[model samples]
Every structure is written in C-alpha cells, then in structure tokens.
Target: MKKCTIIGKTNVGKTLFLINFAGYLGLKFLDISLCDDKKILKKYKLSINQAIYELVNDQTHKTRCLQSIIVDVPMGKGKKKLQLIDTVGLIDGIHSNIEIRKAISHTLTIVRVSDIILHIVDAASAGRDELPSSMGEVDYQLAQFAQLKRGYAILANKMDLPDAKEGLDKIKSEFSGNLIIPISALHKKGFKEVRTFVAHNI
Candidate 1:
C-alpha cells in the first residue's frame, strides 16, 4: 500500500506517465479512459461537480471489492502492489500565494511517504529554453526533497526529438549519478528499464 505521487507542475506528463507506468506494473486501469469519454461527460453535462459526484459514488462499490479493484495480476507471483497519483497545479520562482504554496508544499509531504520518487523530465524543453521550465524547478526541488527521504529516479521523456538527446551530456552532468533514463513515451522506448525499476524499488 505504498503511495507514490507523480509530482510535477501542470502539463509535464504526470497523468500520462501514471497510466503508462501502471501498464508496466501489470494494472488494468480504467480511470482516465472513462474520464476522456465525451459521451459520458457529455451525458452528464460535463460539469466538474457532477463528475466528482459520480466518481465518489462509483468508488464506494469498488472499495467493497478492494483486492480485485487494486491488484490487476500476480507480478512475480503476487508479490507487490503499486499506488500512483497524478496532480495538476502550477508553481514558480516568480508569482505565488499562500494557497499555491500550500498546494506545492503538499508535494514534499508526498515525497516523505513515497518509496521512490520517479522524477520525469521534459528533456527537450529545459535545455532549449533559457527560462526555467517545470522540469528544471522540479529537478532542483526533488533533489532537495530526496535529501530527506525516498531515493529519486529521473526519466528523460520526449527523447524522440533529436534536440532532446542533443544535450544529454549536460543533463547527465547536472544530475550526476542518479539514474537518468532517456525514454520517449511516444515511441515506447526505454520502458523495460522503467518496468524493472518499479518492480525493484517497491
């Protein structure tokens, strides 16, 4: 029952990675797929409150069948369970408020409880842009966060682009010895390592 929050700023592939990573962990997740179905959300008028209500109502039934709900298959003969959470919110060195800080501060709380922090980086974005992308700030913050608990792993996503691999040397030097993997989620490359990592860590 280890809880792992896929922590990063908005649009940094946190939600997408959770689904992909769950597949690697042998879980049959039906969450976001249902959320994406326009027919369903449309049938309910696509209101956020209604969606929340439906989710809560549905989970009550699912919770009664907890084992069947959580575990998809016997991985290495029924040895493990993985819990993943994806979050959205923005933060920066520039503008912020107590509310925003409190939300971002929850990341460190998640850090404390996770067995491993899988820090995914948008490799192409950070090296090209002079300004800090979410990856840059996330890297620095999680580095500081890791000083306390949960060893972190870096996944250099979006590696399909030539520009992504172009600055590998620099990124490697910056992260030093932490396991930084070059993987393109779009291409399914580098997932074997990611799969092995999850199994090994938890």
Candidate 2:
C-alpha cells in the first residue's frame, strides 16, 4: 500500500489532523499501528473521539513513534487503501532528549520511504516569533529534501485563528512554487482540497 506521512514541528496539529482527516474520510473507528524504532508494530483500536482524547496533546513531542492507519480513498469504482502515518514532531536544534531524537530519526527514515509527504505548518504560529510550532530551519530543509518526491505538499494549519492569514501569506511567499493547502485541522476546513490532492497523487 502507498504510505502518506504527516510531519511538522510540535503543537502544529499533526496528530489532530491525522485523526480528523480519518474522520473526514468516513472512518468511525481507527485501527492504529504504532511502530517504534525497532520496527515492532503494536496495534490498537479506538473511536475517533477516543483517539483524539488519548493521543492528541498540547505537550511537545507527545507522539513518540509512528502511528499509522489504513484509509480507503475512493477511486473510479472501487477504492485505494493507503497507509497514513503520523510522526513525532521535529525541532530545529538538536533535541536534548535522546528518545525524541531517536523518534525524529525514525520519522526521517519514514520520510525517505514514504510515497506522499504532507508537511504541516502552523499558520497562526508562522505569524508569530519563536513558537515551537513556528516555521523554522527544519521546515525549509524538509521542503528542499521532499522536493524530489512528486507527492509533496504543505498544509498550512490553524486557519481558524485570526493570525493564520498572515502566516499563510508568509508561507506562500517563502515556499512559492510548492503546492499548499490551507486547512483548519480543528474544524476540518479545506479537507476537500486535501482529499483531492491525496486522491490524485495516491
């Protein structure tokens, strides 16, 4: 199956996007596969609400591993099942915590192999300075590296906030020529465009 990985700095709504995107795709229950550094996969099942409550958090690096779910994208008549993986949040400087560094390494490894890359950035934070979720050096490097892939796009998240417009404009100016989809992950806005992009690529 094709794999689509969601990556971004912490508190940028990567986890919320994962769960809500699945919910947008009509999935009532998520069958999640948590893959660690050793490549050992542990499975769990949860409803959309349950998944959000348990997994989504405001803390930095809350997601320590690869959390994956299989979702069916409608094709001509049948459907295409793709592996949508949520990754640990990445930071600019070297993370002091060893485990987080390892998780970041694992996320990078997954990025190298993924068929599609959905790079999420916080639009509201992008308008601000020095926030954890603000666009940084890592995001720039990621855009450069993922350029080799055909299915790379930037998701400007948190559009519901007042500051997001400025952030989105900044992202557009900085990341020109790249495909960008403005989305409010919390409210599920701009999901149709995202779904279309995924469908066309996958």
Candidate 3:
C-alpha cells in the first residue's frame, strides 16, 4: 500500500479532492457517520435516518475543510490501494484550528509512516505574487510543508478561475521540479494527471 497524506489550508478543497478521489475509487457513502470518539453519535443521539439525511444526503461532506481525518479512503485504483488522509486547514497564525492542530500532529505521524505527501494549495486565492497566510504574510503552512524532506507534489487548485495561471507559473518557477501541478478539483480538470502522478510518485 502507498501511504500518503492530502494537506492544504482551509477551504483549499482538500476534503473535496479526497471525496472525489474516493468516488473515483468507488467508496460508498454509508450512513455510519461517527463523530470524534463517536461522541456526536451518542450526544446528539443521532438515529440512522438522521445520519442518512445529515451525512448521506449531504454531498458536501467532502467539501468540509477540516472535520476529521478520513482514513483508508478508496481512490478506485483496484486492489492496490493507497492510504489517503485529509488534513485540516492551517491558519497563518500560531493559533491553529483544533482540527488543524490535530492534523498537524496526526500528519506528522502520517508523514513519517507514509511514502508521499500530496500538498494542495489554492492557487486561485494565493496568486503568484506572494504566498497567502492567515496573518497576511508569507504562508506559514507552505513554509511548514516545504520543510518536510519527503516525496511530495504540489497541486495548484482552481486553475479554471482567472488569474490562476499566473499563480501556477509562480509555483512552477518557484518550485522548479516535477512537483507542482495545475488542477481544478471543482471542475474535475487535471484530475487524470493528478491521479497518474500520485499513482507513480507513491
């Protein structure tokens, strides 16, 4: 199995990309939605019907930025499965979200144990001029990930949007490797290339 982590800040489509990959892998949306430690299930006392409506009928479950780390996510690559994890969005400041903080620690475990890291960035949002951050400075999350000495690839998402090409250029020129890739998860564009790269890189 290929151990990998899908990392990006909030609203960068990390979960959305993973969900699409799961769909590509043919993962069925079961009503077995459980909260952290199954607390929400017991606290809310959610019934199966409720779960179906809340998590099932809701297609945007994947759209969530940082709720939990979905494990063993399918990517439709046959029996040779890849370990896919959706991490939380990293805030620009030191004060990270609870989910993101958990992801950072959990991601360390995943990165150490994994073979590759799929780091996605919101190219459309960040732009090519300067990296975006919660503190309105150099993207701290990008800096953090760049420090990782591991097999990783960059996906500059939202390429369909205007001004994204410039950002894509910035990433390509800045990274200078077969690492950065232009993609739009929302449009399902560049998905084939992204999948193919992960298939080979991992």
Candidate 4:
C-alpha cells in the first residue's frame, strides 16, 4: 500500500486531521496501528469519537509514536488503498526527553521512506510570532526536502480559525512553488481538495 505520512510541528492538528480525514472518507470505526520508539507495533480498534478523545491533545509530543490507518480512496471506477500514517510531531530543536527524541528520529526515518508526504502547518499560528507551530526553519527545510518528491503537498491547517487567512497568505508567499490546500480538520472543511491530491498522487 502507498504510505502517506502526516508530518508537522507539535500541536499543529496532525492527529485531528488524521482521525477526521478518515471519518471524512466514510470510516466510523478505525483500526489504528501504533509503533513506538523501540519499533514495537500495537493495533487498536476505536470509534471516531473515541480516537479523537484518546489521541488528540493540546500538549506537545502527545503523539509519541507512529500511528497509521489504511483507508481506500475512490478512483474513477475503483478504490485505491493507502496507509495514512500519523507521525510524532517534529520540533525545531532537540527535545528534553530522550524518548521523544527517539520518536522524532523515527518520524524522520518514516518521512524518508514514505510514498506521500502531507506536510501540515498551523495557519492560525503562522500569522503570529512565538507560537510553537509558527513558520520556522524546520518547516522551510522540510518543504525544501519534500519538494523533490512527486507526492508532496502542504496542508495549511486550521483555516476555520480567525487570522488563518493571513497565515495562509503568508504560507503561500513562502512556499511559492508548492501545492497547498487550506483545511480545517475539526470542521472537516477542504477535505475534498485533500482527497483529490491524495488520490492523484497515489
């Protein structure tokens, strides 16, 4: 299956996007596979609401491992299966926790091998300064690296929030040559564009 990894800074709504995007694709219950820093994998079954409550969080590094789910995207006459992998949020500098650092390392490894890259940036935070998910060096570097691949696109998340428009504009200016789709993971807005991008790439 094609592996499309969701990567971004902490608290940028990557987990929420993963869960809600699955729901948007018509999944009520999700079979999620989580891989820890030690490379141990575990699977779980949960409803959409349950996964959101248990996995989504405001704090940094809430997703310490790699969590993935398989969903089929409708093509012209058939469906294509792809693995939507939600990764540990990447930070600019070294993390204080060793385990988190290991997780981040694992995330980078996954990024290198994934077939598709959905780089999410917090548009609301990008409009402001000093926020964790604000436009930073790491984002620029990731954009530079991922742009070399065929299946790379930016997801300007949190478009439903106030000031996100300004943020999206700034992101457009910064990422002039890349494809960006504005989306609100919480409200399930702009999912059609995202689906189209995924389907085309896969």
Candidate 5:
C-alpha cells in the first residue's frame, strides 16, 4: 500500500486532521498502529469520539510517535488501500527533550520513504507571530523537498476560525504554484477536494 504522511509544526492540527479525515472516509472505529521512537509497535481500537478525546490536544507535541491507519479510498468503482500516517509534529529548532528529538528524527525518516506528502499548515496561525502553527522555515523547506514527489499538496487547516480566512489568503499568496486546499478539519469542510487530489495522485 502507498503511504500518505501528514506533517506539520507542533499543535497545527495534524492529529485532528488524521482522525477526522479517517472518520470522513467512513471509519466509525479506528484501529491505529502506533510506533514510538524505540520502534516498539502497539495497536488500539478506539471509537471516533474516544480517539478525539484521547489523541487530539491543545498542547504542543501531544503525539510523541507515529500513528497510522489503513484506509481505502474510492477509485473508480473499487477502492484503493493507502496507509495514512500521522507523524510527530515538527519544530523550528532542536528540541530540549531527548524523546521528542528522537520522535522528530523518526518522522523525518518516514517522510523520506512516504509515497505521498500532505503538509498541513494552520491557517489560523499562518499570518501571526510566535504561534506554534505559524508558517515558518520548516514548512517552506518541507514544501520544497516534497515538491519532487508526484503526490504532494498543502492543506491549510482550521478554516472555521475567524482569522483563518486572512491566513489562508496569505498562504495562497506565499505558496503560489502549489496545490492548496483550504479545509476545516474540525468541521470536515473541503474534504472532497482533498480526496480528489489524493485519488488522482494515487
């Protein structure tokens, strides 16, 4: 199966997007495979609400490992299996915590081998300063690197927020040539376009 990795800076809604997107794809229960920095694997079966409550957090770096789910996207009359991988959030500088540093390293390794790259940027924080989701050097670098791949798109998440429209406009101006889909992961808006992009590439 092809792997589609979701990556973004800390607290940028990567985990929420993963869970909610899976739910949108008709998964009522989540069978998530988690891999830690030490490469130990564990599995959990969670209800949609339970996964949101336990996994999604307002705090930064809530996900200290890689969490992935196997999803089937509709292709013509059939479905195609794809691995949707939610990675530990990236940061601008070296982390002080060794565990987080290791997790970040692991995330980068996954990126190198991923078949698709879904780079999420928090539109609510994009034009702001000193926010975890604010567009930074890391996002620019990721876009540059992932552009080499045939399956790469930017999801400007959190369009439900008040300031997110402005941020989305800023993002559009900044990332002029790339495929960007403005979406609200919380509300599942603009998901069809995302699915279409994924389907076309896959």
Candidate 6:
C-alpha cells in the first residue's frame, strides 16, 4: 500500500489531523497499527473519539512511535486503500532524551521511503513569533528534501486561527514552487482539497 506520512514539529496538530482526516474519510472505528523501535507491531481497534483522547496531546513528543492506519480513498467506482502514518515530531536541535532522538531519526528514515509526504506546519504559530511550533530550520530542510518526491505537499494547518492567513501567505511565498494546501485540521476545513490531492497521488 502507498504510505503517506504526516510529519511536522511537536504540538503542530499532526495527531489531531490524523484522527480527523480519518473521520472525514468516513471511518467511525479505526484499525491502527503501532510500530516500536524494535519493529514490533501492535494493532488496536478504537473509535474516532477514543483515538483522539489517547493520541492527541498538548505536550511535546506525545507520540513516541510510528502509528499507521489504512483508509480507503474513493477511486472511480471502487476504492483505493493507502496507509496513513503518523510519525514522531521532529525538532530543530538534538533532544536530551536518547529515545526521542531515536524516534526523530526513525521519522526521518520513514520520510525517505514513504510514497507520499504530508508536511504539516502550524500556520497560526508561523504568523506569530517565538512559538514552539513556528516554522523552523527543520521545516525548510524537510520542504527542500520532500519536494523532490512525486507525492509531496505542504499542509498549512490551523487556518481557522486569526493569524493563520499571514502564516499561510508566508508559507506560500517560501514554498512557491511546491503544492501547498491550507487546512484547519481541528474544524476539518479544506479537507476535500487534501483528499483530492492524496487520491490523485496515491
């Protein structure tokens, strides 16, 4: 299956996007597979609400491992199934925790092999200054690297925020050549465009 990985800095709504995007695709219960550093895969069945409560968090590095789910995208009369993988958040500098550093390394490795890259950036934070989720060096580097891939796109998240428009404009100016989709993962805005992009690429 095509693997589309959601990557971004910590607390940028990657987990929330993963859960809401699956819900937007008409999934009430999700079959999720979580893979640890040892490559041990564990599967779980959770409702949409349960997944949010368990996975989404405000703290940094809440997700330590790789979590994946298969979703069917509407393709012609039938459907195309692809894997949506949520990775550990990438930080700019080295993390103090050895485990977190390993998780970040794993995230980078998966990006190299994934079929599709959904690079999410916190638009609202980008609009402001000194926020943890603001656009950083890692984001710029990731954009440059991932754009070389066939199915790479930037998702300007948190568009519902007041300052998000400014942030979106900045992202557009910086990533003029690449495909950038403005989305509010919390409110599920601009999801149709994202779905279309993913479907065509996958």
- Model 5 residue 96 CA deviation (Å) reads 0.6
lDDT string, candidate 2, 1-202, tens digits: 9999999999899999999999999999999999964575789899999999999988888899889999999877878999999999999999999988988999999999999999999999998754888999999999999978999999999999988999999999999999999999999999999998999899
Q: In terms of lDDT, which candidate is strongest?
A: 2
**Candidate 5 — worst ten consecutive residues by lDDT sum?**
35-44
Candidate 5 on 1-202: residue-level lDDT in tens? 8989999999989999989999988999999999853454999899889999999989999999999998899999999998999999898889999999999999998998888899999998985654767998898989999989999999999999878888999989988899999999999999999999888877
C-alpha RMSD values across all candidates: 9.4, 1.0, 6.2, 1.2, 1.3, 1.2
| Alpha-carbon runs more than 4 Å astray in model 2 | none
Query: For candidate 1, what is the TM-score?
Result: 0.68
lDDT of each: 0.52, 0.93, 0.55, 0.92, 0.90, 0.91
Per-residue CA lDDT of candidate 3, range 1-202, in tens?
6656666655566766665655554555522222232132322333323433443221222223223322343245554556565555554555434654554555445555556677777786666333441112323445355547456778888788777877777666666654677887666777777677666655
Candidate 3 ranges beyond 4 A from true positions: 28-79, 96-100, 128-150
lDDT of 6 by residue, 87-178 (tens): 99988888999998988888898899899999999999998844689989999999989999999999999999889999999989988999
Candidate 6: which stretches are off by over 4 Å?
none
CA displacement after TM-score superposition, residue 9 of candidate 5 (Å)? 0.4
Q: Candidate 5: which stretches are off by over 4 Å? A: 36-40
Model 6: lDDT of residue 95 = 90
Single out the weakest 10-residue window by summed lDDT for candidate 2: 35-44
lDDT of 6 at 17: 97
lDDT of 6: 0.91
Q: In lDDT terms, how accurate is model 2? A: 0.93
**TM-scores for all predictions:** 0.68, 0.97, 0.66, 0.97, 0.96, 0.96
Candidate 5 global TM-score: 0.96
What 10-residue stretch in candidate 3 is worst by lDDT?
57-66
Worst 10 residues of 4 by lDDT: 34-43
